[model samples]
Target: MRLKRNPTARYPETGEKRTVSDEKKRGGAFALAQRLGRSLMLPIATLPAAGLAMWHTARLSRRRTTGALMISVALTAFLTGITEPLEYAFAYEAFPLYAVHAILTGTSLALVNALGIKDGFAFSAGGIDYLINLGKSAELSGGYLAGPVLLAGIGLAYGVVYYLLFRFLIVLLGFKTPGRDEDESDLDTFEFAAAAAVAADRSKQKVVHSHRRA
Candidate 1:
């Protein structure tokens, strides 16, 4: 589900109206101070999508640093259950990380199912969806806190494991995950531009030579 972005996502994160080079000002500082996890990391284990989103986006979006796309995407997956953007961050290069993600996601789903934790989503299986479905799940299971608490516990543990494991693999193995890898397309563009300039220069030189001969 595409998160309808606030005209200005604020600090309590950033208030570039929408995003920015100016992120570190205040909003950026807050999320950074906590490192986003210092709890946001909890969601990916349950949602098994993001927290890593913020981590990866932070790295890749250094150009934007605290830009809107980075901030919005990370939050969207946690709140709305949209993860394609986040997944794309490392999906192409880090197939191994993706495989790990699949295992963790499957485990989350299977465990929830086995425990009979009923939940549903209107847009996706995000926090809002979880909340909306909370009542239904609780009634069926005869407890309120049980579902949230258990889910939180599992999600946090999984989140930590993923964070540490992913960090290790990315750092140690040097997976060309997004920000870490230069886009071949960018290199191609540069090469093409250079060739075009060279051709143009040669064409001009030929015309000048012909004029001198005349």
Candidate 2:
């Protein structure tokens, strides 16, 4: 009896016909997943701090109309890490600003870590846990009061950086961000042409009726 071999088997690296030893190498999916997962750590590390900063800023900057409402909205984002709704509103419309946000978030994490202030929560790095830990136990809280100062600076820096960079990039690259590309004249021209055509048709119809009457 002879042993059978799989014709479809291919080398992982070269995509050539696979031999028995090819099984020693890892599959493409596994390799790609590992690489991509490692790359995600930087962004994931920043989310908690970013959520906290946004929540705190909204809470402190309340107005008569939107004060309480904005605070509640920011709190939800802080606790849940569900920023997609807010992010989607401006991410594509102002991509450079979004990129600055990501950079500032990473900076916030770095500043907190460097200050020897360590804090972690099982759920999320939201205000609830942050406040709870503040009074719970100094040993556990890791003296996170320093966090607010760092976050304040990060928020201010983020605003200035985002504004300046967004303006520069928009002018330099000519990106079609939300308000930059609309042409009201084009629509006005179309409307004018349509109205003129309608008037001409009506006049032609009136001439035909008068001639028939005559």
Candidate 3:
């Protein structure tokens, strides 16, 4: 009679007895999916906010260029919720534009606070505080009138300051603010591809090692 052997004892690569575990592989897939989801959500959520900002900026336009820039900044802020990017965009033209934007943002916030206007939804750091405070104070002040007045004040301040200061800053300084961010760099898709390839190679090596040990 021939001797019989256990079939499960042999590994696929090394032909030795060992067990295989898929847990790590599954975990990696889950992590990757989560990261991708978050990345996509970030840009998606801000687009609406930026779009609304653009509309508001356009409405306040006395001329063309400054209005366009404000709209762009609003869009950028809404989309990324980051003012630095928008600030840096204007840094090259008229150093005073930076000061102008800062003053306008502060003045708008103050007027919003003083008049008690509430923002329906906040998309960026720029105006979110003013709206929130306005909402809270509106609630505390008994009714609708106080909030509307404050909101009007905010609108007025934003329009006037943005118009006057932007014009002055552009005319005088001719752009170029300090600490401004430079234009965005290229995406470099190759780096991501290389990283992925390296990870795949590592995983393959791991799988091979495990089999050999088995």
Candidate 4:
């Protein structure tokens, strides 16, 4: 006689339905994405202020190294929205810290927007546009005093809040950010080597082609 298989029977190793733990992990990932998306608003919202802050910080720094660093940070943030590199480095490992970043970003945006401060640019928001706008007219550009004050406050709040919240979350969650995961480290190293090899090969080919033309 043929035996009938049970429809509800699950393999010992693989369960048919997702467990609570699995569901939580999925939820965490979604939450991280949501927070990261929200965090973007902060950078985009503070483009003009961020550019001004960079310029002011660079001017205030007595040391060349400090000024260079400040300028680089400002330019990168303004031009390309490259905040993701640093943000993702922290976000992938310490999701809670990223969440804090998102909250702070939203708060800063709200505060600035509430003050009726608005900046427009044809290209990416950054130092170039900020300076351009400033050159145009101080009064026309939402006045001088309120814009600077709001920017300063937002900058200070971002720095302090991010530091405190990141530290607290890291300690509390024991997050495994970059350099904390063995497997991830190995993978990164391999990928880097592979990319380098490909770049080197391309360079060599270019040199050979140039010699052939010559």
lDDT value for candidate 2?
0.39
- lDDT of candidate 4 over 28-77, digit per residue (tens): 32222222222233443343233233223322222243334334444455
lDDT of 3 by residue, 41-140 (tens): 1222232232233233332222243334445545544443344433443444444555655554555445444543333222222343334434433453
For residues 1-214, could you state the per-residue lDDT of candidate 2 as single tens digits?
Answer: 9866433333333332122112243343223222212212222323333323333332122222122322333444455433443343236655765787677656655654444443333223344444443432233223334433333345455545544555566557665432234442335334433543454355446634543442
Q: lDDT values of the candidates?
A: 0.49, 0.39, 0.37, 0.42
**In model 1, what are the clashing residue pairs, if there are any?**
10-13, 13-27, 20-67, 44-48
Model 1 misplacement above 4 A: 1-70, 182-214
True lDDT of residue 142, candidate 1: 46
Better of 1 and 3 by TM-score: 1
Report clash pairs, candidate 4.
none
lDDT: the better of candidates 2 and 4? 4
Give the lDDT ranking, best first: 1, 4, 2, 3
Give the top-scoring candidate (TM-score): 1
Clashes of 4: 0
Q: Candidate 1: deviation at residue 200, Å?
A: 41
- TM-scores for the candidates: 0.56, 0.38, 0.36, 0.47
lDDT of 1 by residue, 1-214 (tens): 8977543345322222112123233444222221211122234343243335334533443424323433455565677555555565556667887787788766666665555443333333457655655554444444665555566566777767777777777777777643454553445334433543454355446634543442
